[model samples]
Target: MRSWKRRGPTYCKDTWGCPRSQRKRVVFNKFGQPIGKIGKKFTNFLGTVARLGAELPIDQFDWRQVPNEKKEDAWEVVQDYYDVDEMHKSWTLSNIGTKWKDWKCYLRKTYFDPGFPCTDDRVIGDQWTGLYAHWQSSLAQKHSITNKANRSKQVMMHTNGTQSFACKRYDLEKGSGKVLSRPELFKLTHTKKNGKIVDKA
Candidate 1:
């Protein structure tokens, strides 16, 4: 034996009912009226077809053509977004505020020939030796020390391929002389015309 279920209403074939699952007792909004269902099914169908079409390997597609005047306006919009300060920071130089006359005098009196040295060949008594003695005396006066053994000294030398010279000094404890390094001596002898230090001969 089989039981038969009773059907309340047959509304599937009705054109004014639910479009997909056509029901007679259709749901409604606050206003008592039939709510149409055609728009939902149309939108769903179009979305599914678009998803399937995207899987195809289409190389080119048509885009709305932009005019030349509009393209230039778009370029200006891109340039306006750039940061001004970050772009110019690396181009700036450090300013030490040293006077030009003082630097020139220091170079002439401390390193040049005929300034302190009697002649170029006299090694024991040269411009550098006098500069070192003056530096030692300055240090002694600053520290108020009477003994020469209480001073500290430093020296840097600069050199080229063939010729070299002593160019820098401080003051040494218990020593009556100056010293120089290869790089500093090179700068005093072979500098650029613009007063920039040169690394190579």
Candidate 2:
């Protein structure tokens, strides 16, 4: 665990208008790449960073819309705990933004879309206190809803359990004594140990 101290909780100067504290202490898990519960925790931390560190609104649609400088500031906030080196700064920034986007989608689909009250501190946490209006407006937009419905209709999903494609690729490459191309990697990952292919097409 690592505790990162920040100036305070802040938000859009004219819109969300959250007060800035003198100092706020945040604890982060000194874990490997954000995945599973660790990823969710990191996502929430990114949300806090958007509201406080970047002085951005909670409803920002595109992560890329956030200024690179502000994103860098957020990256600085997390790099130490995540063990990301300065050399990988670009990837870290992109990862942080992507994680935040994934997190909002999760919150919208699981909690907000289901009519769950956002005020439940135990369930949603204090970090999302001011997200109701934002969720109702920008996040719940028509195109986004359509996209969510389309994604839910996905028929064939990965059967690789919790292991990521990158990890599986690494294992396959190590065992085969040759680097596998995308097609080969896809074929291997989709085929079961019993020789049953996951995708018929």
Number of the top candidate by TM-score? 2
Give me the displacement of residue 141 in model 2, in angstroms.
3.0
Per-candidate TM-scores read 0.13, 0.59
lDDT of each: 0.29, 0.56
Candidate with top lDDT is: 2
RMSD of each: 43.1, 11.6
| Span of ten consecutive residues with least summed lDDT in model 2 | 10-19
lDDT of model number 1: 0.29
Q: Write the per-residue lDDT of candidate 2 for residues 48-92, one digit (tens) a residue.
A: 454342344345557767676667667666653444446555655
Tell me the number of clashing residue pairs for each predicted model: 13, 0
